[model samples]
Target: MSSTPPVPPVVEGGPAGSAPGGSQSGHAEHKFEKWQMKKIPTMWSRTWAHRGKISFGLFLAYSGVNIYYARKQQVIRDTIPQNTILHWRITDGSIVETDTDKGYFQKILRATGGDSPSPVSSLIDVITTIKRAKDDPRIVGIMANFSTANNKTQQTKTLGLAQIQELRSAIQEFKEAKAKALGGEDKVSLIAYTDSFDNQTQYYLASAFDKVYMQPSGSIPLVGLSSTVPFFKTLLGRFGIQVRAEARREYKSMVSPFTETELPPPQKQNLFDLLKGLNSQILADIAKSRQRALGSDPVEKLNHLIQVGPFMGSEAKDEGLVDGLLYKRDCGKLVESNGAFGLAHYMRVTAKEHTNKLAKTGEPSLVVGIVYLIGGIKRGGGDFGANTVVKGIREAANDPTVDAVVLRIDSGGGDVVASDTIGDAIRWCQDEKKKPVVVSFGNTSASGGYFVSTHAKAIIAQPTTITGSIGVASLRPYFTPEFFKLIGVSVEQFFTGSSDTSLLHDLEGAALTRYKRQIDATYSDFIKRVADGRKMTIEQVENVAGGRVMNGKEALKAGLVDKLGGLSYAVRLAGDYGLEVHKNAGHLSSDMEIENIVVKVFPTPKPYLQQIVESMVGDEAVDMYVRDKIHSMIMRVWTGDMMGLLHEVGLSESSFQNAPVSERILDTLDTELNPDNSDIPDTVEVDEFDEIVSGVESVKSLEHDCDIRALCIVGYTRRKSQSNNCCMRGVEDRRLRMLFEQM
Candidate 1:
């Protein structure tokens, strides 16, 4: 808080407002004295009468109105930002993720190293944000801001392979869409500009762009891919400590670290297979993207370039690893937009736009609720805390307005009980409510992740989505007498039952037998669920089980997923299923012609209180945060195309007769006019018919192959628009004339 006070307001007719050299005459001074004396009595009387309550109230009211509208105007301005270049920076901090609150704060404290908002590139953030930018006409291009050396927060040698792969996929999709949208003209440009490019993951991501610009004097080193794991069993033995774990199968590898000095053949084969697959995928993506950019086969070039470690900027360009060598300052000039802006500001504007749009279109738009199942699974319901995802699933299913559902799953699996609870909820939604539920995988969805998703209507995953770790294991810790003596602590156990409490201690005899049986039972159940959910045989599922993890492509071949695609593709599939349901219910036309239907997005405030307070927040940071939150909320409601979000609100063939008299007559006219259902009404009163003729005539004059009955239904249900109202008037005129002539 600052000590400074706001400047005072100007007073009328005071010396501060007057010319410097002026002086009042004696007669005029006497008049001023008389006026002041008269005003003093009234001022005192007013203060005494009401204690100045009304005066203070009026002042507050005036200030609040001004503040509120000022904020609103600022939001409006942010929404209409046009011809802007977004400078997006991907930082190490952005990619770092933690599941616990303590870890989140720890990451923030690490800021002593220097903290700036890095694009976290979490699956949804990277994929959806890039997708939004691709569709947003105002964004001309994007440049990867990878100059971390000068900044406090620095990226690690190797970025997360999963994040890099997801981002690269988004970039590729953006370019493809841009090309189609532009009709073979100049495409939406994507450029990678970095101080240095070292990590294989970083190289793979950068290679996806049209041009890769390396900072002059910077190097492209460390192009190799490898995995490292240290054996701690030897060290633990010297310390007189022991560790043990048991699994249902040999390939589980849960106890490998503590039980073996070196990886067994099976475990070694598993690790090698996963790594080989990932490395091949990275190499393939880099080659494909570079080939398109360089206009030649890049397989040989990339393979050769991989062997040469750490090339200078100029050398990298010559070797075809990079397109050019330039400084960050010059890279901005390449992909020219109408103007330049940071990506953060652009995000703020987009959120503001979404909030305003929802204020208007939210009621009518089909709700496609996206319930994100992030983090580990626990025994609570969804509230964005801990690992409660079941409640969110139930909430989406219970909403009457939701036409479809998308469950975005990103987890390595946890807590079988919680996982089963969610699975039951998903099954309930599909079996009882009959709403289509589509599951879209993110970075990881193995173990318990795959368990909860078994009952989904359709499962979709990215080509790189890590899935299918189908097996179970159990661990029991036993304390030795020496271990407690070294720690200077004593432990004791008591039992009340006659059967004994051996289950709490190290297993042996019958206790050990019971533990093994339990483990076996859980493993059997996991296998059964996979077989039933995936529509595979028990033998086939067993072949893929045993704690084996595979990427989406491999999982699809194993029948673990119905299809291999991203969230957007799954969303469209859900929408298709929803549309079919509405059609079957007679809410939509089987053959209704669709032309242009313009809807106003970016709505104004519909709530009375929100209007007063939303624009009044004095802090810019607070405003931006709130605005972005609003956008995130809207995006969750439905993340599909606008047309897919429209559901019938008023008249349908089944309900037309129950509608208002005017709507019923309009529906009759529509049915009579269409050849598909051209049966007209049998009985009509001529006098009543004449009265309705005038209404129909006005609608027929509109230059649209307008559905008059539909217009009449919407008139009673939806808010009126000037253009639509005018067309409605024209339709009434034409319809009446045509009806009278036919009579």
Candidate 2:
């Protein structure tokens, strides 16, 4: 046992103005000494006090300078000076996370109290400057530095497969529109540039341009697509971890990554089929975009190109991948010399300047809201991928001018509860507000994503849209002694309650029965929700509810979707619905109320700190922590399934934010110690419901020990009743026998 250390005595000055180590009578000296001691803390306080003032002064000064520069830029842009070429620098990897709304800077200043302007704000200023230049006939051609703007993910996911197809279709529409706008299609010329053209998605977009240029050193990697599923079973097994999965269909390969060493035969076949279909589509698109006339031999030509070694930019030009090879500076020259005002210019001229433009534009007699649902469905109110779509719908419903809503869904779905909440919100908008809602599938909308869409009046899907996955799956793996056996470690859990032991392991005795019942109930609820939405019986829903994949076309035939069309079709339908409402209401209009102005004021991009933190703390840890805290607080009032229980223990392999403290602590220790071995247990048990079941089991055991006299008396009474009514006695005996058999 260590003893406590002695406390030091405090030293005091004798009198005011006297030095701490000097005579007691000098007041000035004492004051000076006192001031000296308080210097650091006092200085810190003063610095903080003046810091805001200094920052404000600097901010105002900067704003004044920016205003001066902006005015100058605008004047230069507007002056119809001849040979004034506009250079639109498009740097590679320059993706815009946010757009500048009109008067955004004023809003930003009011909210953030900062001098430095944001990127989006600067971009808006640039756009405004360019718009001013648009009227100047002397500004001949617009040159974009194409080295930037390589957003592969956004190009693929955000634009989506359907959107891309629509864009391609739009080109044909645009050609007709261009002829109407420019007198003829021949007057328009499009030019595009790139550094290296390895991005297939980017190349597809580039193909829309009349001419594409690349650097001499740049190479286009136009090889066929390949997808690899990394098997982690061996690694998990080495750590004595087992992944248990129960999926309804052979093609439900999402869990195969964790449980199996390699793809099962059924899963392999499914994967191959999917790959073949996807690759075929890709090949077809490439042939169409490239204008290659290989007929049925396009794949062979593509393979031949891949077999050739190191095809440079010039070679790509020869092969028709690009029109020419040029340096970065030459793009400006090309634009000034030969570039003509094309469809891109028209888009730039007419593109909606702000999100609110839809409402403000005078052309709209009746408003139809296009609620963009494009993210994950999470529990709480902030944006989570597709859940944002629901919020958009709610906003649309409240808008008086908005008579109808179109939910543009493009997601793989997320939390079940979130999906339910979103679906309920849509239903409320429809029933309470009497608004017509339509759901439009973009790329892939399935599971929870599809669940929300079921509430719509009509559902539309593109040909390639992946729509149906009418099932829910929960994965829970138990560690037990297997983990301890590998590490040569053991744990002893002690508790007073008979049910407490169940928490440390899988449910046993009464706990198992209760757990099974909970799963059945939750599953029943899931089925019922779908049944109600789709106008099917619960049993009918279950028949298709077992995790099976279906394409958009298949879903329509199965009554999962109402129509097969693109986003434009959905929008048109929404407009039609809105028009019907307008005609019925005699063109009555109302104002829409926007919520949480304070939150919207500073619509800053997600902070880097939060992104870093999320990356470090795995989803399992966060999910477990949230679930455990919620469970402790509302144990008595809980009504969900054992599926939620799996979430509490970090056993469920789903992405959520309720991480366990144990996991966080372990992560911290692992980082700090830098040990060769991790001390965390391979598995954790999460069955808090076991307690309720144990109590039930105890009651059942007591019933079994009832006195023989009591039993005999009951039997004698039953025999007398039987004598009075033979039919009743027979019915009672049958029921009793059934009950006894079940027990």
Candidate 3:
């Protein structure tokens, strides 16, 4: 330890090279340099000890600066230019409400260009964008791109007719706003372009614009509309399978497909009337839009033209269905020659300017809460998500800040109890919370959708929206022993109770009578709800409640809905009612108008982490999954995908969704045997029939109280062998568990 000698310390220098040790100048300098080098190494070593933390801190700082600059650039890019045209691309990705929540992964994915943008704008966004454009000086026009709305491959569905009408209404509003802004100059324009006008619906939407263009090779399939009902009685009879279903009234054609071999006269007439009404509306709208080109008798001319369709690009232009023929690139150049941006970009750039303006201005504002009740109204949840709608309504009603609520419905109905639960919540919201609730119908809000909204303060719908299916049907399949024998299968059952409603047993005798009584009670309850809500007599409600679907126009006349208008109109009504209530309660002055109404969506999307955690560790998640699967199966049945499956058993595919099913099946089978069709698979194995049924007898058992409204396509899957085995096992497990519980 004492092997080294002590070193002398350097003293402060009086001059450049002076040292306190009284040494030569060069020697002193060398000592000082040695000491400085030692000190520098010590400082560097201490700094290097925290290299990981230092790197991390530096990265965060760099990211902050990067984010600031990127946002600045995006703001500049999204800004509207002079005389700019906003583009609205209508595709299937369009959402009804604003999707405000984006997770960290979503943000990162978008930043890294891994996420593709939605091809279309939603209804609310589209309307809001137009409203903004109408006020902005820089925006001169809008161009709608509906090329992706309808696909020739039948892989994509067209936008709902009612949604198209809503868009049309917005466009009209935009035109009116422009005219007023220019003191009747009407300089602003709307232009529509598509690769091809694939159907009457696409062309119908295009006709709403000032000028319409299509690609040179495009064709307008403007053929007239035809509604086809698929009758399964004949096919089921061949297989010795029976379907027993009861309807509240004769007009409830939902059961006709199972009971009748062909469309009944009453249903056919009702369907014809609906078609005629819709066709008239279409002709009238087209005639009004094309008045300048059609001269006089425009509706008659349009009808004549439709009889001669489908028209090629040139033919359609000559017939005045379209204005010009041009490629998509040229069309884009023509529309956006001055400057342009997507409506989404415009919305993003201007959103900050519109956020809660009432709060900023210190003005008295009405807060309206919007709740979306979309898809089949199942008990746990619908197709929209895992959250029950009742919770959303209760939360909104209980919120002190929210003054009113608007329930936006876009469903074709589901379970009775689910609908009733939502309805009860609505009543409680109004009776207990004293908040006004308005309903806005979108596309097809019928049956259970209408049921839940029966007690709302007001109801609104688009003229083309399908609503008012108030009747109920209990449908079930009865499999005979002969059918089981044909399939080389037999099922044995032992039961002590006489109340069995299982699929393995037929619903007859006392059980069938009891089921009928339950159906009658539900129907009576439905009628009473409607009558009480509308302040109408039972006779009046019954006259319109025979399981009949009506357009908003008919619904208003029949007193089924309060008004025929879009969601915006409904929200305004809700705000007005809320303001009235405030005035009556002495909270607001009578002169205070409902200004700067703020609307918010309920049941906000959960955080990404929370969603993952809940999905991984909750019975709610499992229940939601099961309900979603059942709803999906029900949708497939109603939408005629089941008919496609039965096409394999000699049913004509043409009867299902108007496709040539028999030809497709023959072609698929021939592909295996014919060397020329080498592109297809070599064998038609069980797995090869991806969407086909393995066992038609397999059925999902619902809760005892839930009525069987329709046949659920149980065990539906895209992969036959594996999915069938898994589904069968699950069904067996559930059946055994239920049996044990019963014992």
Candidate closest to the true structure, highest lDDT: 3
Each candidate's lDDT (Cα)? 0.63, 0.55, 0.71
Cα lDDT tens digits, model 2, 1-743, are: 99998755434645454445555446678888898889978998898899999899999999999999999986654333454444443422221212322333434432463332222222212333344344444443344445534433222112345554554454444445444555665544445677776555556556655567888898776665456999887887777676555554555566788888898887687557654555555556666656653345656566576567346887887777777888877865765654233223333443433334544753344456665555566775343433344546656775656767777677777777888877887897889788888888877788778878776788998656776666655555556577888889988876676642343365566865665565566556766777777898877766656555566666777778888777666766776766666567765443422211100211223333333333446434534443444345333422342234334433342321232432333233333222465432222122211122222223222323332222222222233343453222222222222222232
What is the per-residue lDDT of model 1 for residues 430-548, given as tens digits with 9 covering 90 to 100?
88777888888877888888998887888998777778878886655445566677778787777675322343255678866777888899999999988888788899999989988
Segments in model 3 whose C-alpha atoms lie over 4 Å from true places: 1-68, 95-121, 150-157, 183-186, 356-359, 382-387, 504-511, 610-743
Q: What is the model-wide C-alpha lDDT for candidate 3?
A: 0.71
lDDT by residue (1-743, candidate 3, tens digit) is 56877665646654444456555767789998999999988988988998899999999999999999999998789666888888877644343444432545444433453234353345666676777788888877888887755433222445677877877787887877777875673577688998887678878877888899998899988877778778889899888789889998767788899999876776677778778887888788889988887777898998888788899988888888788998888887776566888878788677766775544877767889988887788876433532357767866986789999998888989889888888888997899789999999988899988898899999999888888889898888888888889899988887787635766677878888888998999999999999999999999999888888778899999998998888878888999999899999999889988666777778655545544434455545644444444544543343454344344333343442233333333333344223494433222332223212212112212222111111112212212223233332222223222222232
TM-score of every candidate: 0.66, 0.57, 0.74
Report the lDDT of model 1 for residue 490: 80
Can you tell me which runs of candidate 1 are displaced by over 4 Å? 1-83, 93-129, 135-137, 149-163, 180-187, 292-297, 307-312, 335-337, 351-364, 380-387, 485-505, 585-743
Ranking by TM-score: 3, 1, 2
- For model 2, how big is the CA root-mean-square deviation? 23.4
Task: Estimate candidate 1's alpha-carbon lDDT, on a 0 to 1 scale.
Answer: 0.63
Instruction: Give the Å shift of residue 409 in candidate 1.
Output: 2.2
